[model samples]
Target chain A: MARDTRERLLDAGLALFAGNGLAGTTVSDLEARAGLRAGSGSFYRHFTSKEALFEAVVRQELDRFRTSIGDTTIGESTVADVKIALALEFHEALTTLGQLGQLEAIIHRDAHAMGDLFDEVEGLYNAALDASAARLNQLMESGQLPRRDPQALAVTIRSTLIGYHLNTQSFRRSARRVPPADLIAILIDLISSK
Target chain B: MARDTRERLLDAGLALFAGNGLAGTTVSDLEARAGLRAGSGSFYRHFTSKEALFEAVVRQELDRFRTSIGDTTIGESTVADVKIALALEFHEALTTLGQLGQLEAIIHRDAHAMGDLFDEVEGLYNAALDASAARLNQLMESGQLPRRDPQALAVTIRSTLIGYHLNTQSFRRSARRVPPADLIAILIDLISSK
Candidate 1:
C-alpha cells in the first residue's frame, strides 16, 4: 500500500510538473491529484518538497525509458529484417519521446539551474546514441550494411527520427505530407546498400 | 528615439522570455533590461501588458526568420555545389533554431493555452518545409538529384539537420562523435542517386 501511494504521487508529479512547471505547481495540487486531501500533509509523506518530487518524477521517467530500450533486442539476419526492426525501433522511440515531452519541456526550462539533472539526462541520451552506433557497426562488419561511418550514420538516423517527431508533435507542422511510415521506408532505402 | 526604445524592449523581452519565461518575467525586468527606469511606466507607453510584449517578441522573431529564408537563393548547378548550398542552409537554420530555443520552450510549455499563436508558428514551419520540398522537386526534375519522393526526401534531410542541432545544442550530447559537416556529407551521399 505504501509503495502504491508513492507511485501515485510520482505519477501525479509527472503530469502536474509537465503541465504547470515546477514553480507553478503547488504541494496541495500534487496531493489532490494523487488522491489525498487538498490541504493534507500527505504529500510530505512521500516527498520532502516539490523539488524532490520533481526529481523523483524525472528519475522515474528515465528509468522507464531505459527499461524499455533494454527490453528490446535486435537480431535481424537480412537487410529486409533489419529495416523492419529499425521501423519498430523508430516507432518505439517516438512513443517514448512523446511520453517524455512534458518532462523535456520542464528540463529545457530549468536547464540553466538544474545542471546536474540535465547532465544525467544528456548522459542517457548520448549512451543511447552510442549503443545505436554500435549496432550499426555490427551490421556493417557483417556486410549486412554499407561501410560508412557507423557513428555518423547512427546520428543521421536518430536525427531524422527525432526531426520527424518534433515536426509532427511539438511543431505540429504538416511535414509536407510525408507520413511516418513513408519517411521510414524512404530513409531505409536511402541508407541501405543498393 | 521612441522606435529605438521599442526595439530595445523587444530585444530585452526575447532574452528575458527565453531565460525567465513569460511567467517568471516582470514588467520591471523588461524596463530594466531596456535601459529605462525599472519601476517606471515607460513600458506602458510602448506596450499594454507583458502579454502584448510577448506577442510582439514572437512575431518579430518569426518575421526575421521568414525574411532570412526569403533572401537566400539556391542556384547550384552541380551535385557538389548543391551539397555546399545545403550545408550553408543547414548552418543558417541551426542558427535560427538556436536563437529561437527559448521561445520554443515557452511554446511547448504553453501550447495548450496559446492556441492561435501556436497555429501561427506551426504555419510558418510547414510553409518552410513546403518551400524546401519544392526546391528539392525542382532539383529532381532537372536531373540534378535522384527521382524520389521529393517531400519525403525534404523531411529526411530536415530531420537529420534538426536532430544534429538538438543533439549538439539543446540536449548537449556528444552525438557519438558525428560532427555536423560529416553528417551532412553522409546524408547527401545516402540520398543522391549513384
Candidate 2:
C-alpha cells in the first residue's frame, strides 16, 4: 500500500505538472487528485519539495527516453518504415506523458535551468539525429542517396520533424489528424529524388 | 521624448522577455533596465499593462517581419531571381531569429489560445507558400518550369525550407556556411530539372 501510494503521487504530479505547468500546480491539488488526505502530509513522505518531485518525474521520463532510443533499430528499416516507427514513438511518448502539452511545458521549463535536464533533452534529439544520419550514410555508401553532406541532410530531416511537432500542437486540439504515412512518404520522395 | 521612452522600454522589454520569458520579468526590472527611476510608474505611462506592452513589442517585430518579406521580391522575380532572394531571406531570418529566439517563443506561447491566432500564423506560413506557388505558376505559364500542383509543390518546397531552419537550430551549428548564391544554384538546379 505504501509503494502504491508513492507511485500514485508521482503519477498524479506528472500529469498536473505536464498540463498546468510547474508554477501553476500545488501539493494540495496533487494530494486531492491522488485521493490522499489533504492534511496527511503524504506528499512529504514521497517528495521533500515540489522541485524534488519534478526532478524525480523528469528522471523517470529521461530514463525511459534513453531506453526508447536504445530499443529502436532504424538501420534495418526502409525510409518509410523508419519514419513510421519514429512517429509512433513520439505519439506513444505524448500519450504516456499524460498530455502532449506536458512535453512542451517540460522542455520550456527545464531546458535552460537544469543541466541534466537539458542534457537529457539534447541527448534525445541527437540520438534521433544520429539514427537518421546513419541511415542516410548507409544509403549514400550504397549508391542510393545522392552525394551530399549526410550530417547536414540528417540535421535538416530532424529539424523538420521537430518543427512539425512545434507547429502541429495548435491544430492538434481541434482533433484534426495528419496522415503520418502520407507525410513521411512525401518526405521520402523529396529526399530520394535525383 | 515620450516616443524615445517608449522605444527604450520596448527594447529593454524585448531583451529581458526573450532571455527570461514572460513570467520571469517584472515591471521594476523593466524600468531599471530602461534607465528610468525604479518603480516610477513610467511603464504605465507608455503601456497600460505588461501583457499589452509585450503584445506591442511583438507586433512591432511582426511589422518588421512583414517588411522583410516585402523588401525581398522573390515572389515577383525571375526563377533565378526568386531563388537568390529566397536564399538571402532564409539566411537572414534564420540568423536573426535564431539569436533572438522570440519569434518561435511567441508562436509557441500564443498559437493555440485562439483559432484566429492559429490562422494568423498559418497566414504567415502560407504567405510563403503563396509566394512560391505564384512563382512556380508563373514559370509554368511561361514554359520555364513544368506544370504541376503549384500549391502542393510550394508546400513541399516551403516545408523543405522550414526543415532547413529547424536543422540549423539543432545540429548545423558548426558546418561550413553555404553561400546564398550556391544554395540558390542548387535549388535552381532541382527546379529546372523538372
Candidate 3:
C-alpha cells in the first residue's frame, strides 16, 4: 500500500511536470492530481517537496527505462540466428525510447540543471550506442556479419532508430510511415559487404 | 526601421517561447527581452498580441529553415558528385534541425493548439522530406545511383539525420562524436549495389 501511494505520487508528478514546466506546477496541484487531499499535507507525507518529487520521478523513470532494455544479448549459436536476435533487440530498445514521450519532456526542459539526473539519462543513451557497436564488432570478428565497416553500420542503426522514433512521435506526421521491420531489413542489407 | 523592430519582436518571442511555455511567458517579458520598454507598447506596434508575435516568429523561423536548405541540385555530371551534393544538402538540413534547440521546446508544448501556425511548421517539415525523396527518385531514374532500394535509402537518410541531430544535440554527451562527413561516406557506401 505504501509503495502504491508512492508510485501514484510519482505518476502525478511526471504528468504535471511534463505538461507544465516545473515552475508552473505547484504542490497543491500535484496533490489534487494524485487524488490525495488538496494542499501539501498528504503530498508532504510522501515527498519533502515538489523538487524532491521531481527527483523521485526521475529515478523511477530511469529504472523503468533500464527495465525496458532488459537484455542486449546479440547471439546464441548460429550466424543467421544472431542476425535475427539483434534486429529484435534493436527494435525493442528503440520502441522504449520512442514511447518515452513524458520522460523526453522532462529532458527537454534544460535538464542539465538537474545535474546527475540528466547525466544518468545521457549516459544511458551513450551506453546503448556503445553496446550496439560492441555487438557489431563481435559479430564482425566472428565472421558472421560483414558491413565492410562495422563501426559505421553500428552508428547508422542507432541513429536511424533514434531518428525514426523521434520524428514519427514528435511530428505526429506521416501516419502511413515505413514499418520498423522494413527498415531493419535495409540495415541488414547494408550490413552485407558484397 | 519598422521591419527591423518587427524582426526584433519575432526573435525575442522565439527565444522566450522555446525556453518558457507560452503561458509562462508574458508580453512584458518579451518586451523586456527585446530591449524595448516593458508593458507591450512597442510590442503593439509590431504584433497585436503575444499570440500574433508567436505566429510571426514561426513564419520567420520557417523562412530561415528553408533558406538553410537553399539548393538541392544533383548534377549534370557524375554519380559521385551527385552523391556528394545530396549528402551535403542532407547534412545542412539536419544540422538546422539538430541545432533547433529553441524551436524544439515550443514544439513539445504541443503548440499546435495555436492552430495554423503549428500546421505551417509541420507542413514545412513534411515538404522538406518529400523534396528529398523526390530528388532521390530522380537520381535513381536517371541511373546515376544504382541502389536496389532507392526509396528505402531516402527514408533512411531523412530518419537517421533527424535521429542523429536530435540525439547528439540533446545528450551533448559526445562533443567529439561522429562527424556528418563520416556519416555521409558511410551512406555513399551503403548506396552501392554491388
Candidate 4:
C-alpha cells in the first residue's frame, strides 16, 4: 500500500509540476491530485518536500524512457528497410518525448533550482545523440547510408525531429503544415542521396 | 518621457516575463525593474494591466524582427556562395531566436491564458516557415539547389536550427557537443549532395 501511494504521488507530481511548475504547485495540490485529503499530511508521509517529489518524478520518467529505448531492436537488411525502421523510430521518439512535454517545460522554467537533476537530463540527451551517431555509423559501414560525419548527421537528424515535435506540440496550427511522414521522407532522401 | 517609460516597461516586461513568468511577476516587480518607485502607480500610467503590456512587448519584438529580416539581402551567385550566405543567415537566426528564449518559455508556460497573442506568435512562426520555403524555391529554380519539396526542405532546415538552439540554450553543457558551423556544414552537404 505504501508503494502504491508512492507511485500515486509520483504520478500526481508529474502532472501538477508540468501544469503549475515547481514554485506554483503547492503540497496540498499534490495531495489532492493524488486522491488524498487536501491540506493533509499524507504528502509529508511519502516525500520530504515538493522538490524531492519533483526529483522523484523526473528520475522515474527517465528510467521508464531508458527501459523503453533498451527494448527497441532495429534489425533491417537493406537501405530501404533501414529507412522504414528509422521512420518508426522517429515516430516512437516523438511519442515518447511528447509525453515528457510537461516535464520539459518544468525543467526549462526551473533549471536553476533543479541543479543536479538538470545535469541528469542533459546526460540523457547526450546519450541519445551518441546512440544516434552510433546507429548512423553502423549504417554507413554497411553501405546503407552515404559517407559523412556521423556525429553531424546524428545532430542533424535529432534536431529536425525535435524541431518538428516542438512546432506541432507548441503551436496548434503548425500540426497541419508538415506531416511527420513528409519530413521523414525528405530527411531520408537528403542523407541517403549520393 | 511617457513614451520612454512605455518602452522601458516593455523592455522590463520581456526580461522579467522570461525570468519569472507572467503570473510570478507583480506590477511592483515591473515598476522596480523599470526604475519606477515600487508600489507606485507608474506601471498603471503606462499600461492598463500586465497582459496589455505583454501584448505590446510581443508585438514590438515581432516588428523588430520583421525589420531585421527585411534588411537582409542574400545575393550569392555560386552554390558555395549560397552555402556561406545561408550559414550566415543561420547564425543570425540563432542570435535572434536566442534573444526570444525567455519570451518563448513564457509563451509555452502561459499559452492558454495568452489567447490572441498566442495566435499572433503562431502566425509569425508560420510566416518564417513560408519565408524559408520561398527562399529554397528560389535557390532550386536558379539551379543552385536540387529539386525537392521546398516546403519540406524548409521545415527540415528550420527544425535543425531550432533543435540545436534549444539544446544549446536550455542546457549549459550542450553548447560544446556540436558547433553551429559543423551542423550547418553537414546540413548544407546533405541537401546539396547529388
Which residue pairs clash in candidate 4?
Answer: none
Report clash pairs, candidate 2. Answer: none
Q: Rank the candidates by lDDT, best first.
A: 4, 1, 3, 2
Model 4 gets an lDDT of: 0.78
| Quality of candidate 4 docking, DockQ | 0.57
- lDDT digits (tens) for residues A58-140 of candidate 3: 88888877766555443333546665767776677666766576787777764754678887887776666666677778777
Select the stronger candidate by TM-score from 2 and 4. 4
Tens digits of lDDT, candidate 4, A1-194: 45688889998888877776677678998999888999989899989988899888888877776676676565332536777877777777777668777667677666776778777777777777788888889889989788899888888888888777777767854543778888888988898887
DockQ of structure 3: 0.47
TM-score of each: 0.86, 0.75, 0.84, 0.86
DockQ for each numbered candidate? 0.59, 0.25, 0.47, 0.57
Two-way TM-score contest, 1 vs 2, winner: 1
TM-score of the A chain in candidate 2: the value is: 0.77
Q: Please give, for residues B1-194, the per-residue lDDT of candidate 2 as tens digits.
A: 45588899998877766555555578888998888888899889988988777777677766666676676554555546545555665565455456445655555544332334456555665675577678678778977665555665554454445445544443334223433334334444445444
Q: Candidate 4: which stretches are off by over 4 Å?
A: A1-6, A27-32, A36-45, A75-80, A173-176, B1-6, B26-32, B35-49, B75-80, B173-176
Best by DockQ: 1
The value of fnat for model 4 is: 0.60
C-alpha lDDT of all candidate models, in order: 0.76, 0.59, 0.70, 0.78
Off by over 4 Å in 3: A1-3, A19-29, A37-42, A74-79, A147-152, A173-176, B1-3, B23-29, B37-48, B66-71, B74-80, B98-101, B148-151, B173-176
